[model samples]
Target chain A: MTGPKPLSNLMEQFQKLPGIGRKTAERLAFHILKADIKDVARFAESLRDVKEKVSLCSVCGSLTELDPCAICSDPERNKGVICVVEEPHDVFAVERIGEFTGVYHVLMGVLSPLDGVGPEELRIGELVARVEKGGVDEVIVATNPNVEGEATGMYIAKILGGKNTLVTRIARGLPMGGDLEYADEVTLSKAIIGRLKM
Target chain B: MPLYESPAVVLRSMKLGDTDKIITFFTLYYGKLKAVAKGTTKPKSRFAGRVEPFVYCNMIAFGKEKADLLRLNSCDIIEPFGLVRGDFEKLKHAFVSAELVDICQKERDTNMEGFELLLAMWRRLSVEGDARKQDLLLRLFELKYMSTIGFHPFLKSCVDCGGDIIGPKAGFNAIKGGVVCHKCITSDPAASRVFVGSVKLMGKSLEMPFEKLDRLKADPGLQGDIDKIVAGFVKYHIRRNMRSERFLAL
Candidate 1:
């Protein structure tokens, strides 16, 4: 035996995940160690399955167990409109609403020059090729209302310019449950700009 | 070996291989700049708050060519733009503004006006009650940006016949780059139509700054017209439709 339990190694792996701190990692490692063998096996199996089965769709960059993904393969979804999101998580988030009838293109990540992630690092060239070749009518940018995401959206919008495609971005303002009195000036202002007359 | 220092805002930041980070900056002097802050991601690294996104910092950098990615020798945090960090709406609006700077600013081109505009916008939003001014602010940036980049739309004269035009109402031809006289409109097959009233609104928008705009009550129709005109102008010059603008409009 190489000394203490492999808790340190497990914690290190957990820390690699986004938003997981060292303390959380330790807690997770301990939880996993104390869990039933069957549960542990199931967790391990799921992780393996995700890696072994999941691959990017050729049409959109969404992770899928099969090529083209279910959404891209589906005939019912609006082929004319494509909702573009920054990551796969956004794809799931939108899907949860079940409101968007259009298909999607997962950008995988947004443009962040500070991080050295640029146009080249992103799937932008692929998006252009898709736009140029595909029979797309409108492109809805569903990226996070953040700087990198906005930059990415702008870059994509410029690239797909005048190709007969109508490009759009999600409106930002007050949240569903937000109180107007508690809302700050920026939020209230954005809400007013983004308001839809019911 | 000369070291230059300037004020910059972190547009975005990401962790590099092991301990370093890559930060994209909208700088006061250089416009858009990308720098590798070595060991920035580490706990003890000096670049901690200096390179964080949405934070403004005064940085010292060393590089041979202007195009060469600079090495950050030192960074002192200025205004953190802290109001943007946690607040979602503020964060989003600030990001859109920052992204505009990133897109409009040419690398190594010193655009002090654009820099000042960004700083002013940030400062304004950081204060209370600036939200009602959001639309005006964005429009202001678009107008100022277009002016700075030499794409100021022709609002007064007939772009085609060079006729002395009346203001408060006019037509716009994206192809012709200004108010298209009724005679000129009939001549061009692809020109988009605009109203005389709409043209006046556009004229007023183009002439006035954001501060003056906030106090003035805008006719909804006029505001819509101005928005459309500015949108079309931006689309024409940027050579692409802004996807976000459309979605946000929706």
Candidate 2:
């Protein structure tokens, strides 16, 4: 037996959210149905408000309430070092670390031939134009350490090969508290190859 | 399902949804496998670096009841071979090798030699120093891969007539599966002329076991022919090109 058309429609919408599998989606839909009327209205308003207000920064390709993201507008930050990443979420990941004060150029995606995502599909040309405009000293590729990520990272390296800017890849190594014997070969080798002298 | 574990090389990996990855591996006992690495895309994911391509890791994977693809749980590093990712040329060779096994091999098909050959080549690329030297091993690895999958190309004899390659320039008929004799080259229009030196070195490389692979030699002049023949053979037989090569070409 099925619920009313509106309830089923709500379930379908909930299912569309990221990481919400069928069972969890069903649970969420039921929870929404039982929620306080005012609270539900606020949640729905927030979703619509975000969609209307959030816009991609023209300069850096990150989602922001304003045109140029704060990072791009902030003169205090290091404009010389631009950390290239695949998506805006990655910008958040780097920001959480808080060690990096450099601005970011979100590529929107990496070069993935299988999925038909090439350099043109990404924000690579904009990145090059930004770098070519001058004042950039280095480009640290912070794309994920996966195949497409690495390929995208290297593609950035290749494009900026001629410029005076120093190009580099974010180091791949073991996570905190990880044991040597338990590390994967690829990660272990990266750690070994990237080790610093004490 | 019971938790299964094996030493596997991360041949390919692609994003699945937002925070997951669908990874392909060439494993030791289980052979080729496609598994889900949950949360691999997370910033501090436990599976980070373990699921990256070119990595050789001891993987623990399990399936939920009757699922086709296993869920990758945790992994221990067996060999990262970091230099392969550090150097552009080395990275290209690694991708081609990984893509070869990924495209050609069938699931659950156990080919121990193929597994070992991949590991050995990655090991070589780790410190091979010269990019050309690292690429040289890929040719041999491709040959070995063909042999494992039961399409071993004939290098010594004509693929068409099983006769000797008589001329200084050996013709390669990728369609016919290997070198063609002077007489047989006329029989196959698809056959293209390849240097005898390339054909000869390929045969010698295939004959030697993986352990002594370094001893095989080819002159710098003949390297181009060797590359051509190998590329032709792989392109024709495999019918799929390595996508990574295109990025490297750029």
Candidate 3:
């Protein structure tokens, strides 16, 4: 049997990345193949550096070269209102809106029983313990507006049900099944404002 | 060990460790459940193609109580939602619909009605054409889902005063939950006033069924009026604006 060409192998690898399909992967692979050596080297090095240097923030799960993410360390952010999301990418999504003046806790994933993801598989217990220790007044369930996301938010709400902290779900203005990263500034801003206590 | 069976729709499936596969399904009796279909990834496995996304199946699984995963015993495909996979727009609409059910319904709690609503919409998407009609159908589904979950926006009469003063031309109070009469809006200390045209649009939306909604249309000017009313009220109450809706406008 003949092995795939180097270009074909590169396209296959690129396809493994989320949101990249076979056609898009081929385009991306060709683009990389045509790029200058320096540009390609920069791209490759950045990927390596991200793995080698980036670590999860001690307080939140956001990736950072520092122990605490920039937001976690900043004194200006409202530490009292923690905006909890499911993944590190969501941290960026919330930041782009520019409305929330709070820190975050990335659960790493929502509860997906089919994939064997449960509370222990996520950063949920740590979040609860963080709230239990006090000072935090609100926990915003900003998980992706999808099934696993809602369940994860609900489970968090139930676990933190009686705690002194107020629990709320991020308003669903972002569309029923859409990803948070795609929401416009106006909608994201309004969702933050319209968040109702759960 | 606890054993149970439920009517489920496969939302997604993927290979697991060697010879096994992990399948995620939304069920009628148990909400959402995951099972390890051991050896199902192999070429000779019985579960091949039967457990993939959009297949409506009756599943039987058993495992220790409180454990996250169950052992798969059987999966019988009742409906594949096959018609949707053939068309691009239909597939997109189906994915969005499945995603809605996946995100909205609670886990471990049976939302049989929601499960049905989702399946019905999937069936409709498979056969329906017009893009505008598809959008409205999804909106109707959203409204129904929101209502089932108890977030139903009050459409008829004042939510605060309980008066029969429905907005004939248009009027609404997003803050007050639904439509408020002109008198109540002007007098109430807490009410937020909204356009009368917007209120009428919302009234029509909440009152109409999904299949029939596609047939109902207004003049271009009136259509804009209706869209704004339904959208504003939805945005105010649901609290999150959808990106697809924004895409639709563009």
Candidate 4:
């Protein structure tokens, strides 16, 4: 026996979300149905607002409610130092650390050759333009330590070779609180190679 | 469910959902298979880093008979090939090799020769520093890989009539799968002119061992011609252009 058509439709929409199976979708749909009417309206408005209001910042490519983004617009941030990341969400990951005061350049994606992603498909040209515009001192490549990420970093360095800006890659090593014995060979080897003097 | 174990190299991976990834592996015993590694996207997951492409590992996965995707149990990395991943040129060639294997081999079809060829390519690319040697290795892998899968192009003689190909020049017919002598070239209008030197370079690269391959060298023009021929042959047989090919040109 099926319920009202509208209720089933809500459940189907919920099922389309990642990690949401049929049972979870039903549970979510029922919860929304039983919630106060005003609360449900506010929740719907919040979803709609995110879609309409949020967009990539023109200068840095991170998601922002306003043009140029808060970090890029802020005078206190170090415009001379640009940290490169793979996606928009990575900007937030770096922000959570609260230690970095530099602006960011999100490539939107990495150079995934197997998946057909190339330099032309990314925002690397925009980055070079930004750097060549001058005032930039260094570029910190903070892409992941995976093969694609490293390749992306190397390509960025290669293209920016003629420029005066310094290009540096994020160091890879064992995570904090992780045991040496538990670390993978790649991580361990990188740690040894990138070891710093006290 | 039966648990299966094999030494495999990751071909590629795609995000499955919020916290899981579907990883495709070219295994020593099982050939090409895909398995879902649950929660692999999580920062602390045990499967992290081990499932990325170019990683050679021993994997244990569980699945029922005829199941489309196996559930990954665990994997231990044998070699991550970190050096290859760090260099852009080497990494591009490595990805091309992986793409070749991914396209040519069928799912669950055991082709140990193809698997071995891929591993050898990875091993050599990881350590080989000279750019020239690296190019030769990639071409060697392409030729050997095609041969193993039964699509080896005929370079010894005329592909059409099996007559001895005489002179310092010949025409390669991508659709016909080999060199067409001057006589056969007219019949095959699609055939492209290729130097005899390029053809000999390809033959010798295939015949020579990986260690001695460095001794073989080709001029820039010869290299360009052979690159086009090998790429055309691969494209014809695979039926689609590989994404890695574009990056290799860069």
Best by TM-score: 4
* Candidate 2 residue-wise lDDT at A151: 73
lDDT of 1 by residue, B92-166 (tens): 556656656666677777887777767766766666354435655666567766776677778777888988665
Q: Candidates' DockQ values?
A: 0.04, 0.38, 0.02, 0.70
Where in model 2 is the C-alpha error above 4 Å?
Answer: A34-49, A75-77, A96-101, A111-118, A145-155, A168-198, B1-3, B14-23, B35-47, B60-67, B71-74, B215-221
For candidate 3, give the docking quality class from DockQ. Answer: incorrect
In terms of lDDT, the poorest run of 10 residues in model 4 chain B is B205-214
Decide which is better by lDDT, 1 or 4: 4
List candidate 1 segments past 4 Å from native. A1-198, B42-45, B128-132, B164-169, B195-198, B205-211, B243-250
State the local distance difference test value for candidate 3.
Answer: 0.71
Tens-place lDDT digits, model 2, residues B113-170 = 8999888888887878875676678777888788888878888888778888776876
RMSD per model, one decimal = 14.4, 3.6, 21.4, 1.7
Candidate 1's TM-score? 0.54
Looking at chain B only, the TM-scores across the models are 0.81, 0.92, 0.74, 0.95
Between prediction 2 and prediction 4, the one with superior TM-score is 4
Docking class of 2: acceptable
lDDT of 1: 0.71
Sort the predicted structures by TM-score, highest score first.
Answer: 4, 2, 1, 3
Label model 1 with its docking quality class.
Answer: incorrect
- Native contacts retained by candidate 1: 0.02
lDDT of 3 at A27: 92
